[model samples]
Target: MWRQVALEAFPDAGIREPIGASALAEAELRLGRSLPTELKQLLLESNGVIGRTHVDTVWTVDQIVEQNLFFWSDESLARLYMSFDAFLFFGDNGGGDQFAFVQKPERADVFVWEHESDSRRWVANDLRDYLGRSLSAGGDDWYQ
Candidate 1:
């Protein structure tokens, strides 16, 4: 149904194959935390959602693991921005900003991390809202 949700927003939204439970388990192990329930459900329905201009509205599990690990551990990023240990990044604006769930507090709400200023702010109420907002829009910076 998640794929349908995306398609409803943008008929051209690209859908990928659903990820298996084992891959999700490994992803959680690598992140050292469980995936958000809504996000997990979405991924199981469709591994990722490609939005306008081919942006990853929802990333695949592998991308999720790699991006989060990089944001949490990269020394260069650590120096440039606030620590990312509290965020589980899931998508990008195709510019430099990224979208994420609050991991430290484990909230369903989604936030945007504006890359240049290192600012994080509320964007969508939840994963479904995020898909609708991002996919239905016409640009990468649609959240803005």
Candidate 2:
């Protein structure tokens, strides 16, 4: 379902191979939280989609781990973690901007973390809604 939405958004995009069950399990262990059902389903279907607008790449499980580690280790970037420690980044805009799932019990909403401002804003209610808006956003005016 998410793949179809992505393809509709960027017909030229390609879906990556599905991540192994062991790898997914390892990621959950590392994250210390169960991946959202929609997220896991999307990954199992396609590790990530390439060549989409707004979110240019849906990061693979390994990429997720590496990116999180890189940002969490940095002094400046790590500052945001103090306030929003529950965030789990999963994609990038290819312009240093990141998208993540805010692991709150009430709702794991999607948020965009702007690299320039070091700020995060709620973007969508969930994975499916995020995919729809991302694909539908024309040009670079993603917020519009």
- C-alpha root-mean-square deviation, each candidate: 0.8, 2.5
Tens digits of lDDT, candidate 2, 35-94: 777888888888976655434457888888777766656786555555445677888777
The backbone clash count of each candidate, in order, is 0, 0
Model 2, stretches more than 4 Å misplaced? 53-55, 79-84
Q: Give the distance in Å from residue 76's predicted Cα in candidate 2 to where it truly belongs.
A: 4.5
Model 1 C-alpha RMSD to native: 0.8
Candidate 1 lDDT tens digits, 1-144:
888898999999999999889989999999899999888988998898889998888889999999999999999998888899999999998898999999888899999999989999999999889988998887888888
Cα misplacement distance, residue 143 of candidate 1 (Å): 1.1
Instruction: After superposing candidate 1 on the true structure, give the runs of residues whose Cα lies further than 4 Å from its correct spot.
Output: none
Q: Candidate 1: what lDDT?
A: 0.91
- The TM-score, computed over Cα atoms with residue i paired to residue i, of candidate 2 is 0.82
CA-lDDT, candidates in order: 0.91, 0.74
